[model samples]
Target: MMACAGGQPGTDAERPVLFSVVTEPIVCCPNDPDDAKTLSDVAGAKIDEVFIGSCMTNIGHFRAASKLLEGKKDMPVKLWMAPPTKMDAKQLTEEGHYGVFGAAGARMEMPGCSLCMGNQAQVKEGATVMSTSTRNFPNRLGRGLLVFSAISDGTQS
Candidate 1:
């Protein structure tokens, strides 16, 4: 999880910090390369959705996803990437990172809490979602929505 500027808790007077949270590979994890062996091992799996934009998902996330999808164009994962701010989105797009994600069959969205907030677009009931946002609680985004923090680079979750 790459923590970018924006989405920090504070007012305009507060300073922002950039950091990333990575986690070690857990045994029996579905996305674990040691267990899966190939992208097809997880392709077309039951994934409710994927939220790729947030303080946890920076350019590194895009690059990782791109590499994962390399030579596996038919991956079956519904991906929605939302940069923490419009500026991040613009810079990423300008740098051609957006194309990398798109080539991997991921959709790019505007910067905002599109799914993290129950009021915004809500996740389907009992749907399994992977996100880069912090916190995972009942009805935090929607009732019974299973939200998992995406671990990137086999270090951050």
Candidate 2:
């Protein structure tokens, strides 16, 4: 299983339940993590913005994103990138990932909780966003935002 969950020990739901058998990467729909679907499910869907950051993401994720965006310029959607820490940002800069992000017209956010907590940066109102944030509850990031949460590779940011 790609994801799993279980209740507390000595309770009625002690055994872990298989959450999903994801053969490939999956993404959660807006406002509902349980409403998971494969990337193909959202094919041809309009994405107004893309966010590849927050606490849930790691250096590897950013590296993968950079690799995908290598030599690309003028991204179709508004792309936001933020590493989990200043150290990650530094490493990506040293590795030239920052240049890739810039070439793609991605907005480089501060290294920490950029758009995940709804505190630092926020997407456009009523925008459809593909994100790596941990959650996609209503109004968490912005008013009337439709946030689809997924791993970096799944979203292909």
Candidate 3:
């Protein structure tokens, strides 16, 4: 936990504080290494699959996604949805967001590191994926995958 203090939180602080201002959404695309690209750079890009769960997502993010998916007739791409915790899944169920996700053809997974880690369910090999996972390292989610690390709203792209 971090607390606000009048001065530095610790006198031994060797690193300077830095602030990142995000005026627009960004996506971390896989390269020979990796690169952070503006969403506009990859607008209208083809995404074979999407994973919407990780430590980066919360109940609010799910709710917002549900709103976007609600009443949709068809989902063109494969969509995977998972909550970070059982409690969040329960809450979303109670709030009917789960129903919305289901109506949109989402494949729900067990909470906690579901598709975020290579150990659990993974997108098809060689598929391009937009994920809320922490990193887009090769094979982190699946073999031969071109992973893009982005926030929940990155799904809009």
Clash totals, every prediction: 6, 0, 0
Clashing pairs in 1: 21-156, 22-155, 22-156, 23-155, 23-156, 53-82
Decide which is better by TM-score, 1 or 3: 3
Candidate 1 weakest ten by summed lDDT: 27-36
TM-score of each: 0.59, 0.83, 0.80
Better lDDT candidate (2, 3): 2
Assess candidate 2 and give its lDDT: 0.82
* Candidate 3 lDDT by residue in tens digits, 74-141: 78889998899999999999999989999999999999998888667888999999888888888888
Query: How high is the lDDT of residue 39 in model 1?
Result: 33
What is the Cα root-mean-square deviation between model 1 and the actual structure? 10.6
Candidate 3 residue runs with Cα over 4 Å from true position:
1-21, 31-34, 152-157
- The TM-score measured for candidate 3 stands at 0.80
Best by lDDT, which number?
2
**Model 2 CA deviation exceeding 4 Å by range:** 1-21, 152-157
Prediction RMSDs, each to the true structure: 10.6, 4.3, 7.0
Error of 3 at 130 (Å): 0.4
Candidate 3 least-lDDT 10 residues: 13-22
